[model samples]
Target: MKKITFLLVVFLALFSCQKTDSEETNPLLNAVLYMQQSAEYKALTLQIYNNAAIHLERALADKNWTAATEQNGDYQNLPPAVILDVDETVLDNSAYEAQLINSGRSYTSESFAAWCKEARAGIVPGALKFCTAARKKGVTIFYVTNRGNAQKEDTRKNLRRLGFPLEKEIETILPRTDSSDKGKRRAEIAKRFRILLLIGDNAGDCFSGFTHASQVKRDSLVRVYQSHWGSKWIILPNPSYGDWESALFDYNYKLPQSEKLKIKRSRLVE
Candidate 1:
């Protein structure tokens, strides 16, 4: 946590004399700091995972209890599995965001891809314990991530190093092969395994129709499926970045930083 804050301080100090406008406007600085430094962030993640543990037991006892909206047919007879989004849910990649801040740049595919390939991400708070306990109870763990297929091995290695369960006989790491939306992948998993829980940091991780949706629409969808939250679906705090952030900018990745910040500020309330 100190490391994250130190990086930001050094970045700002390095430019204190020159002080370019861009240097003063890194939006990710505080978010990354909170993710790294705050006891509240750690507490929230631990609380969510602790809730997930309770729900997992309930789902196991009641065979009819399935988390995925994608689950259908006679899934009770199938093997049980928990589907989790990789980044921010199980893995903490705030270091990568810190790197972006230090470099005075926004996220780019190339930079993120390189970071993933490094396989140096720390596990999210309580993720290792939750996943290990779930695996011990004979629930198969499936990582349904949007990371590109090219990074699959590195992701698997990272998870393995962190003591997360990985089935040798089963290909559990499902990375993005076609589209970024994960609905199809979840549906495919549902066909084979009774999904006991859907855990992630993004709304899109648990349900479809959230990608690229407007802020109001996303909030409405949350209400539309209000019952599922903390029951069938568990969400981790990820204010640092997600579709929630993109929705503020209307999913316009090409928008200038100033424009994006303008849109975000306009949405704020007293």
Candidate 2:
């Protein structure tokens, strides 16, 4: 009788430990793991960049192949350029995301700024090769990131350390100043150069309407510009974080993590 009681207690304790372990799991574990470890992720990034190279060759052959919607009127004679986003586009910041997971905290501007200042981010797969090839072909590479102007220097250091091309005579790293609408920055680039491609991980990187847009509205815009996905606008996969995740919670970053998780879970199809 005592042996049976001891066995029952042991089983209950083991079950309790399992339950606690399951509840304590970090939500970002799988996403970060995929980005850091998966061969499939590497393959996908390589494929996207290879496709971009092919399309770039095509765009260079033609003078009128302007990628930005902001580029209008007599741009055929302008020097060719390519605009790309920094975070998760050219430089991989998954290490920062991994830090957040380990620390059991949500994202904060202060923390992200600290990370940027370190300028230790790894390069995204195939980005270095692609950028180098494009620069060699005489295409001016511009990084139009929404990272605040304060991060511009550190961002440049990171890019330079990674051996990506940077033109000393021109401002290649155009960080956000007064607006997060990247279209204005693209327009600034368009003033002097013919943009051959716009590459990034977010929809806003490709066009201007995606800022703070809802999921439904974002999908609508994606359909509206369906023709540009693989060719003129190349997007790298970013499941860890982006406007897509924020759109699920209605862009309410202030919401408690639990509430945001609940809303995200509710959106999942059964």
Candidate 3:
């Protein structure tokens, strides 16, 4: 936890002079933090749960006609499947984050693995009911996550612990093996089922397995899918790290601490 807070402090101090107008305007996060300090993000998470439920119900019922094109360079034709990214969208591991953050601890793969074994995280705002409903509607629920293969047991235990429906008999939770290009896995899954819905926190998670794309490619892909943003692909807010932030720094996770701060600070719009 100390390490997590230290990273946060390092972030805040370096970027303190550059708080973007949008960052200052992020009300939901403000509310979440306030609720956290005052013992409230839990309530907000519950509220999220209700909204998640509502969103899923609406999506399932929306028989409205629209055509979506899958632009994988190789296999152009894809079939029916609703892909869901794990972590903040379906499973709420904020408790794990909270445990680290509140105690000022940083996350270790091993410690997180242990946390998964305990299986105590909450379901994201509306995820449990949403996934269950999709399954009942005969929509195949494919949990395509960036979590590594090594973390499989804990991820699965955490999902079942939180009551997420495991539709696939073997490894309903698919982990990232090579590049974080999630679309590759999505393509593999699409070979079997037509992906109807793509739900996740990160834009890459929804952009068909694009972890390693250049900034231009990422932007182009976003433009390609702009029409389907809130309908076929549902994006929930995640205030912390993602490829968007990484892109700004060229995905250089090995940068010196000060240089890291400088790069992120450069991008902060005041």
Scored by lDDT, the top model is 2
**C-alpha lDDT (0 to 100) for residue 270 of candidate 3:** 92
In TM-score terms, which candidate is top?
Answer: 2
Cα lDDT of model 2 by residue, 1-270, tens digit: 999999999999999999777546667788888999999999999999999999999999999899999999899999999999999999999999999988777899899999999999998999999999999999999999989999999999999999999998988999988887798999989999999999999999999999889899999999999999999999999989999998999989899988998898899898
Predicted structure 3, TM vs. truth:
0.70
Score each candidate by Cα lDDT: 0.92, 0.93, 0.65
Q: By lDDT, highest first, what's the ranking?
A: 2, 1, 3
lDDT of 1 by residue, 1-270 (tens): 999999999988877746655655577877899999999999999999999999999999998998888888999889999999999999999999999888787888889989988899998999999999999999999999999998999999899888999998989999997788989999999999999999999999998878778899999999999999998989999989999999888888999988998988898897
Order by TM-score, highest first: 2, 1, 3
Q: Model 2 segments beyond 4 Å from truth?
A: 1-25
Candidate 1 deviant stretches above 4 angstroms? 1-24
Candidate 1 residue pairs in clash (backbone atoms < 3 Å): none
Model 3, poorest ten-residue lDDT window? 65-74
Stronger candidate by lDDT (1 vs 3)? 1
